[model samples]
Target: MFNLFVDSLIILLVVVDPVAVAPLFAALTHGESAATKRRIAIRGTSIAAGILVVFALAGGTLLDALGIGMPAFQIAGGALLFLLAVDMVFARHSGLRSTTEREQREAETKKDISVFPLAIPLIAGPGALTSVLLMVGEQGDDPFVIGTVLAVILLVLLVTLVSLLASARIMAFMGETGANVVSRVLGVVLAALAVQFVLNGWQEGFMLIEENASQMLTV
Candidate 1:
């Protein structure tokens, strides 16, 4: 149980990448007032959680029905995740610029910015989705472990929202320079986690192949 929980915890943390997202959140919510920021933070976390939890519960089963193997999924997911990582490193303007512009125009009219750029792509983006499927695949039949890990993910989301609530104080102390430093560090961590995902998939795939070869030889 302990081991399962620990593995789940790692999966949750790596997938969620709360630390990496913090600076981005800070920047996005920069001009919003305290109450608005709080609401946005809470709602954003909720939305992200809902997306991941739904996928976690059904992703593996869906994959099996499709006759897809984990090795194939891993390679595909790794490529998607790596593309996202590249984007994170480069910090490009979202391709939905026209839509974002329209939203921004709407925001100026009504001061609403919670759901548009904040919640969707930034929070519950490709990185999170890949993480969900990969972790679900890794969990296999360990429902106890999966549940525990999910609990930890919820806790982490709560803590991250709390940190976001304290964004004012953190920004006041750290300023943009400090925040950028923190963001870069978190990116490094995310990169390492991404590498680990690839490694684990490769390791398991090779081990399965080895076992199959041994069995055939013995037969």
Candidate 2:
């Protein structure tokens, strides 16, 4: 359980990447009043938290409804995360974890970006959503484990909110270079975790196949 909590925390932190998001948040809310920035941060983080919690709870069911097995999902999710990790390490922007150039342009025009780029793609992007689903699936139906994962999600979001609220300070402290360095370090960790997920998925898939083969032989 301790390991689960730590692993979930690390995975969510890497995927959500509050530190990396701070600069973007600062840029987006540039020149805004302190009060306005505070409001946007609160709203964006709240919406993101709500989305992540819902997905953590129902994502497995949604996958099952689509006839998607956990192993397959794990493999796919890991692959997706690996791509995201690569993007992080290179400090490049991709739709997996950040908004597209087009999306950014759209965001520039929008007055309220809490739901569009901030909540949906920035805070609760594809990588974060996939990570939540993977963690929840790994926990199976264990309510305690699931609860722990959910708690971690909330904790990460709270941290993200704090970062957003203090985006200017964070940007001043870390700057672009420091932020990229941190992201590269976290990216390496995420890459390792992603590989482990893929390996576990392959192992489980092989075990299932062997079990089916044995059943067929017996029949």
> lDDT of each model, Cα atoms only?
0.65, 0.90
* Candidate 2 residue spans exceeding 4 A from truth: none
Superposition-based RMSD of candidate 2 using all C-alpha atoms, in angstroms = 0.9
lDDT for each residue of candidate 1 in 159-184, tens digit (9 for 90 to 100): 66776677667767877676556545
Structural similarity to truth (TM-score) of each candidate: 0.74, 0.97
* lDDT measured at residue 83 in model 2 versus the true structure, 0 to 100: 95
Segments of candidate 1 deviating more than 4 angstroms:
1-32, 82-110, 207-219
Q: Model 2, 1-219: lDDT tens per residue?
A: 888899999999999899998999888888889998899889999999899989988898898899999899999999999999999899888678687788888997887888888998888999999999988875658899779888999899999999999889999998899999999999999999999999999999999999999999999
Pairs of residues at least 3 apart in sequence or in different chains that clash in candidate 1: none
